[model samples]
Target: MDKEVIGPGACVLRGFVDDPAEMVRAIADIAASAPFRHLSTPSGAPMRIAMTNCGRVGWVNVRSGYGYAEVDPLTGHSWPSMPAIFTRLATHAAAEAGFADYTPDVCLINRYTVGSSLHMHKDRNGFLKDMPVVSVSLGLPATFRFGGQGNGEPPRSIPLVNGDVVVWGGPSRMNYHGVLPLEAGVHPLTGNTRFNLTFRAGVVKPAPRLGSKTG
Candidate 1:
């Protein structure tokens, strides 16, 4: 556990797990199943980032609105299962950040290119806000905005690179956080886009089988 406490309830772990390359491979396999798509917000503006997911559940938003879904709305199939490697990394990172027995059921895969950014927001789809979200960054580099727990507070920007893991929970669970627009670059392993895998405990319902159903 390469741990560094970056804030009151935020932390960064460099090379948090062994075999970072293998982790990227596993993520690729997962993405192959669901493929990546530029999702839309409730207001209709397309998200700056392209995304896909792997795990028991995938976070999605469509004409119906934002929520956890069993299938990828685009492929009409279930997203890939959360690989063991991902589960292990999440658990390890969580334990290092002082939360033990953390098993994440949802793995949100976000892809960012130059000028792609995520607005400050909170993760509220899960049951427990106190469980902490473990985010792993790979390929390229980006600035992460860390704001106070309140929505209106000004946020601090932190730079992140490949193999960097950030965890936020407890009082910081409600902290408003996001990624600033990424700069264009080539990461040997991931190329022009920044790959991020965020682990969270999703809802309990069973996810549909990929290639087996369509909405």
Candidate 2:
């Protein structure tokens, strides 16, 4: 895998995952149990992307606020376990980006279709901000903005295609970032949708075994 650095402690690894089809099946099995839903923001506005999660903790935007929880609020059950492939891929990517011993306990899976997007923002939710975030991209391509720590700085737009993984930490962990509106098109793997799996290093909560069924 070729590691390309874009900023301080932020880099991209090309074609990091050897088999995306297997990962897709794994993700489908997970979504079959937990399912994916459009989440509302803290202010009651619905987000553009549909999401679900697998791992010790899942990121959620609930009626109360945005946070992580051991259970999925929608179904009253625990999130699926972080697939071994996911953990292995994330750890390898982080290590290639200079972070070792990355024990990711939260893997948030976000799905985006045409017109889906996100505004620039800093990630302040992960428990271990000191650790790097390992993000895996699959399916459709999208433009990613890597910005400065402050809001006023202009962001650099980078095209991210399938099988690309990014690692961000250190001085760049708090840097502003977001995705541009997705273009209307279909990728062979996922049709018109894009998938982003972000892994954050949080304390483990003993995730359920892989392929466990939930209502």
Candidate 3:
């Protein structure tokens, strides 16, 4: 795989996935247990992208706030167990990006179609900030915006295609980043859809059971 350094402690691994078809099948199985749904922001605006998760914990956002939850809010059950292939890819990608022994507890799967876009933002939830974030792209191609720590700096738009992986940590760990609106496209593996698998070290402590009182 070819590597391109986007910034300090950030890189893009071109065509990192050897078999996009296998990965797509895995995603379909994971989604079968934990189906994708649009999560709303704090203001109650539904995000354009449909999201789901697999692993010990899943990232969640509701009217109350955003954080990691041990259970799927929709089904009131634990998220599907992360597939072995997902863990292997994430750890290997993180290691290639200079973060060794990286083991993510959660994998957030984002589904985007034509016109779906994600606004620039920093990832600062309950996850361990020291760990690197590994993101894998599949299906249709899209533009990925990588920016600096401050908002004043203009972000660089990088074209990402199927099997491309991006990893960021250390100095670039908290940098602002997002994906631009997806233009019309049809990919053989996924038709008009694009799937992104984001791996992160989620909350260390187990979230309180739903509806349970906590201090």
Candidate 4:
């Protein structure tokens, strides 16, 4: 796989997964256990993309707000365990991007169809802010908009195809990123859809407040 650096602490590993079919099968299993659903934003607006999770904790957005929960609100059960293939790929990809010893406890699976798009936002809920976010792309291609720390900053568009992996942390941890509206397309594995697996260290204890004492 060819590693292309996109920023100070971000990179794209082109064709990282040689056998995406294996990963696609695993994702099917995960979805069977935790079916994808559109999570509502704080404003009560339903997000365009459908999402699910597999790990110790899953990212959730409810009327209360966005945060990680140990159980799925929809099913009242723990999210499906993270599959070995998902964990292995995320760990190796993070290491390849310079973030070593990365073992993600949460894998957020996003399903995008034509017209589905994600708004630019920073990943700030995870307490392990030092760890990198390893994102793997599968199926139809999409344009990734990566921006600076500021909310109003214009973003640079990057095209990502199947098997592409993007990892970012350190200096670029809080940078804003999102996916543009997916266009019509069809792939052998996923048909007319796209899947994204975002691995994150979601089980860490919350960091102490600025003035809080720690041993």
* Count of steric clashes across candidates, in order: 2, 0, 0, 0
Worst 10 residues of 1 by lDDT: 206-215
* Alpha-carbon TM-score of each model against the true structure: 0.89, 0.91, 0.94, 0.92
Q: Give per-residue CA lDDT, model 2, range 1-215, as digits (tens).
A: 78889998999998888999888998999999889887776556678888999988787764345667788877789899989999999999998999988888888899999999988988776476789988889999999988998857789998989999989999899988899999999899999999999899955333232211211
For residues 74-167, what per-residue lDDT tens digits would candidate 4 score against the true structure?
7778899998989999999999999888999899999999999999889988557898999999999999999899957678899999999999
Q: How displaced is residue 53 in candidate 2, in Å?
A: 0.5
lDDT of 1 by residue, 1-215 (tens): 55677677679897666776888898788877788777776666677788888876677763356666776777778788888889998998888888888899888889898998999888775446778899999889899998886746788888888889999887787788899889889999888988889898636554233221122
Judged by lDDT against the true structure, how good is candidate 1? 0.80
- Which candidate comes out best when scored by TM-score? 3
Q: Model 2: which ten-residue window has the lowest total lDDT? A: 206-215
Write one digit per residue (lDDT tens) for candidate 3, span 9-119.
999999999888999999999888888888776566677899999999887763356667888887789899988899899999999999998888999999999999999
lDDT of each: 0.80, 0.84, 0.88, 0.86
TM-score of 2: 0.91
The C-alpha RMSD of each candidate to the native structure, in angstroms, is 3.5, 4.5, 3.2, 6.0
Among the numbered candidates, top lDDT falls to 3
